[model samples]
Target: MATQPREESANMGKSTWLAFAVHILTASGALWALLAMVAAADRDWPMMFAWLGVALVVDGVDGPLARAANVTEKLPTWSGAALDFVIDYATYVLLPAFAIATAGLMSSPYNLIASGLVVVSGALYFAYEGMKLPDNCFRGFPVTWNMLVFVIFAFPGLQAYSLAIIVVFVALTFAPVRFVHPVRVKRLRPLTLAVAIVWLGSAFVAASDGMQAQGLTGIGLAGSSIYLLVIGALFQLSDRMRARSAE
Candidate 1:
């Protein structure tokens, strides 16, 4: 019976250490965001996207890590979710908005306006109570300006259309559109994860090519993007039909 106390203490120590590691992992994205911001300020699209890529990776895995670490149970006082949201806002919304505003994608005043719209809508979306639906899909457009802006930067041809794209997405933020949480959504998870992985690979390729590509990587990126857009709507349609039939 004497060893019980030692065992419990060891377990507690391990759990506490894991919680701290998860928090540190989540916070590291902020540093990545800072680096991305610096690159954006220099109008270095390739370098900016590279940094954003690292942040994206950190964001992707930290959720699972936090869950495994039992962060909430181990550190009841510290809100991992809140910390994640703060980091996400900085990396996903603010940094991307800054990039858009500075990329010269749109004409002067308009670029600033568009960037402002992105920031405002994304912030609102993050705070929204109904941001996600029961199916693990995002309720609307999901405030993924990082991905959108990355695409625009990758394809120089899309720059001229940046304003239109931004306006459409901002509107879609509340337009009853369904955006899938690639990893969280259960429906078609295998396909979704496979495509998402390919998308990330293409992202690496896109970065290595200095945002100028002429190969399968570019094609894979485009194809995966189109799939990401279409799959959720397809699932939404299925859901609507099931509901109608049940009714």
Candidate 2:
């Protein structure tokens, strides 16, 4: 009877470990999808954006899923942190830079100069702040905003305006602005979940339609962008308010 219980316990342990492995695999899969989307942007850039949107959705849930499965505690600290940073850099920085280059936005001499300046400035600012305030809040816009800019510009009708806006935002990313970081609250959890679902679903819808249909694409891109922008603003404001109260 003791042997039987021991065998069952062993099997349970194996199952738990397998569940953790699956979570890690899913996270890695999302990263690859993000990379693929950026690479595909050259030919059908909007389609790539759509895929990226889907990956973003997957990322939003992966953490919760891991926690629920009780696998988060089992992950090795170094391995997990390293993977997280890699995914973050790939999805936010490298991919957006690739998309900008592939879209030929930098072909014009003026645009080339502007793009180069924005990237260099952002890099220098990031390096300086990262080195100085290694543990504190970020000094500039997060690179994830680049994904938002890409999604906006990838749409057919919004293409022209989106390009202009993206250029401006690219500069802002390097600007000296202190964006707030809000705490996650229970009341806002539902709204956060809704945003993720809608944004990800819109991407799939846009991709299925080939992004050539201006009306549908416009709705999706605009809706997603507005949703994210509002959320970001709200989060920042809330964080600032909380900080003031604590002080």
Candidate 3:
């Protein structure tokens, strides 16, 4: 019986190490962002977006893996959530802000303002309490600057529109709508993941060769956006019903 406790302690030690490894991967995404910036400086949009995609993949998978390994239980001393948010802000907000500004995607004054807005608003959003809804969805737009920048980079003739989008999403950082978490949201998880996968692939292709099936990739991105809109609407409707029931 005493041996059982020892065995469990050994297992927990392994779990803690596993969690640390995952945290390292999450931090490495920021390193990848540095490489992306180098690519951006060189005007290699394809390679830059590719690095960002890698970071996105790392961010997406690490949460589930951390949970599976019982990170919090095993490593009570270290806060993985804090580590995650720090890295996420860099990869998602700061790096993309740099990319848009450096790539000359938007005109002078506007580009500078847009990039600054992304970094500033994103910082505020991270600091905001209740950023996550009660239902585990993201409250407001979750500051997906990387994805927004990718879309703008892929589609040409949208320099003006791209600036508008950056402005709009920055405003949306304070919006009340609940954005679905894709994998974490219980409702429509499979559909959400499928659409996200398709969108990621489409973004990759679009960024790699902006001229290859440009129209089709644009359509795919639009479809993905529509899916998120539908999900957000459904979440709002559900929340309203829950509120009415409580009343």
Candidate 4:
């Protein structure tokens, strides 16, 4: 009789865990989608960028939260993972593409080709690397990097030149190089950490300073580009360090 009761209790615990896991995953997805939609409709570049930043911050926490809650261990196999990936791609890739198109970034034939290449390259890299498990290391430039590049170039006055720079960075994102996960700080190379800090710091400064610029487009563009380049270099160094440590 006691054994039966204990078994039932265990089952209930499992059900509760599963429910919590699903809720978290669903909430994360909804938040990302909502932000994306807001960005799409408002067409306010700063707001769009702010939302993306928020999404990134949320994403950084989800994994750890799930793990700490043991959600990954107890939740339905692949359900949470699948939903997470879908939401990620939607927020990171599809929405950005829509933003670019709606913003008329593709008005020119050259711009159109460049944008298409960005999409293709990013898609292929995602498809190839995303198939693996644990995702300890990324095989190509992360889409986040490319998306940041796009956001930087999307500024009003720098639109044309920024778009060109975006195309170049997109190509780099597809380049056959590994990018290290930021979570693995112990294995992070010095150069990678330095670059990452500089890049992120620059972004912070730019965002802060631009708030006072009123309508100065170049201010944000220049700051964001510097941030992206440093970020890229950090990714490269981190990836190399991670690969070496793993070996």
Candidate 5:
């Protein structure tokens, strides 16, 4: 019977290392994002967005893997959430900010201001305790500046429009609305995952090629964007309905 506790402790030791490996893999995605910025500086759009895509994949899988590994229970000393937030800020915010500023996505002066706004608002959003809702939605737009950067780069003629869009997203960072978390929101997980996959493929297509590719990608982006907006609205309405029922 006494040996049982030792066996459990040994098993936990192994599990903790597995959990830590997951965190390392996720954090490496941030380093990958930084390298993506180097590609951005070289004006190699394909490689830059490719690295971002890799980072997105890492971020997407790590959480599920960590949970399955029982990370928190195995390694109470390690704070996976803090590590995730740090990597998220780098991959989702800082690298995109760098790309926008250097890639001429917006007009000269406005690009700098827009990039700064993204960084500032993203930092605030990350620090906001209410960023994550009880229902697992983001309290506001989740600071997906990387996607915004990809969209802007994919559509060169929209330089003027990009500035306006950036401003709106920055504002939305502080807005009192919920944004659907594609993986976390359980209502339409399969549909959300499908749209996200399509959107990502479109993003790569749009980033790599010319007008024909851009045209198809644009349609995909528009469709996916509408789906996300509708999902967010559904989350809000559902939460309100639940609250009223409780009362």
Candidate 6:
């Protein structure tokens, strides 16, 4: 009777608190990025990436967790997307850019320009209104410098191409290509998610070995990365072909 109203109120408060906790999870990424910054400053690339990986996992889960908790409905005042963007730019762009500039991966002027372009281009990429497409794909390269830098560190051989990589990807920042959002975008979602997991697992193993991914681990990382990078474009092409056939 009277207890029914009390129980319902208690349940409502519980949902609100759950949403608040989700926000806290999102904010925790900033702390991980801070630690990663320290590691990068000390030239400890592996440890820095380990922290970044933790942040990545946090970022991945927080979106769905926020949705499940109905954070937008409960905490309309707080913008999870805004907070996420801030954290993401720091973790995905800023810290990796710092590492590139500091790690001596390239010669003087090239390193200087490449790292500078990373943050600059990353800022523009994330701020652009059309950065993400309606189908949950990124409209352009999406400024994944963190992943690119990790790959460079893993294969030391890529050091020769560091400058070119930056220049090309920076140009691609505004290109017409579609980049996969992995766990989002329902087409081939199971395969995409599996590839993402493989990539993450490979990342962990590489981080453990001082960011040097060798042997089969290297192959797994490369394969999964290629799949993620190309899948969205494949989807876009498939749709275009289907539309042409219909016409």
* Candidate ranking (lDDT, best to worst): 6, 1, 3, 5, 4, 2
Model 2 scores a C-alpha lDDT of 0.56
Weakest 10 consecutive residues of candidate 2 by summed lDDT:
178-187
State how far residue 24 of model 6 sits from its true place (Å).
0.5
- Report the error of model 6 at residue 77, Å: 0.3
Model 6, span 1-247: residue lDDT tens: 9999999999999999999999999999999999999988888889999999999899889988998899999999999989999999999999998888889888787777898999998988878998878889999898888888898889888888988988998998899999988767888889898999999999899989878889989998999988988888888899999999999
**Every model: Cα RMSD to truth:** 1.3, 5.2, 2.3, 5.5, 2.5, 1.1
Candidate 4 wrongly placed segments (more than 4 Å): 1-19, 22-27, 104-106, 130-135, 145-147, 150-158, 189-247
Superposed Cα deviation of residue 72, candidate 6 (Å): 0.4
- Candidate 1: segments with Cα more than 4 A from true spot: none
Candidate 2, 1-247: lDDT as tens digits: 7799999999888867776675665567456665666457556666666556655555555655665666645555425434545565555555555566556554566445544544564555445535222223344565564455466454545555645766666665665544322223343657655665565566566567664325665566567556655555555577789999999
Clash pairs of candidate 5? none
| Clashes in predicted model 5 | 0
Q: Each candidate: how many clashes?
A: 0, 0, 0, 0, 0, 0
Which lDDT tens digits does candidate 3 get at residues 1-247? 8999999999878877898897787789878888988887888878887888899899889989888887788778888889888888988899889877878877788878989999999999999988987667888889888877777776666666888888888888898877888878878788899999988888877776742326778789868966865687577988799999999
Off by over 4 Å in 5: 1-9, 210-215, 238-247
lDDT of the structure predicted as candidate 6: 0.90
User: What lDDT score belongs to each candidate, Candidate 1 first?
Assistant: 0.87, 0.56, 0.82, 0.58, 0.82, 0.90
Worst 10 residues of 3 by lDDT: 206-215
RMSD of 1: 1.3
- Indicate the residue-level lDDT of 34 in model 5: 80
TM-score of each: 0.96, 0.67, 0.90, 0.67, 0.89, 0.97
Q: Which candidate is the best by lDDT?
A: 6
| Candidate 5 C-alpha lDDT tens digits along 28-110 | 98788788878878888778878888888888889999999888887788888898898888889998888778776667888
Q: Per-residue alpha-carbon lDDT of model 4 for 1-247, expressed as tens digits?
A: 8799999999879866765865575467657567757866877655555565556656656766666666655655646566666666666766666566666654766656655666676667566735332445554556764246444444445565756766766766756555554553334446544545444444444445542222343444455445434553565677689999999
The TM-score measured for candidate 6 stands at 0.97
lDDT of 5 at 44: 81
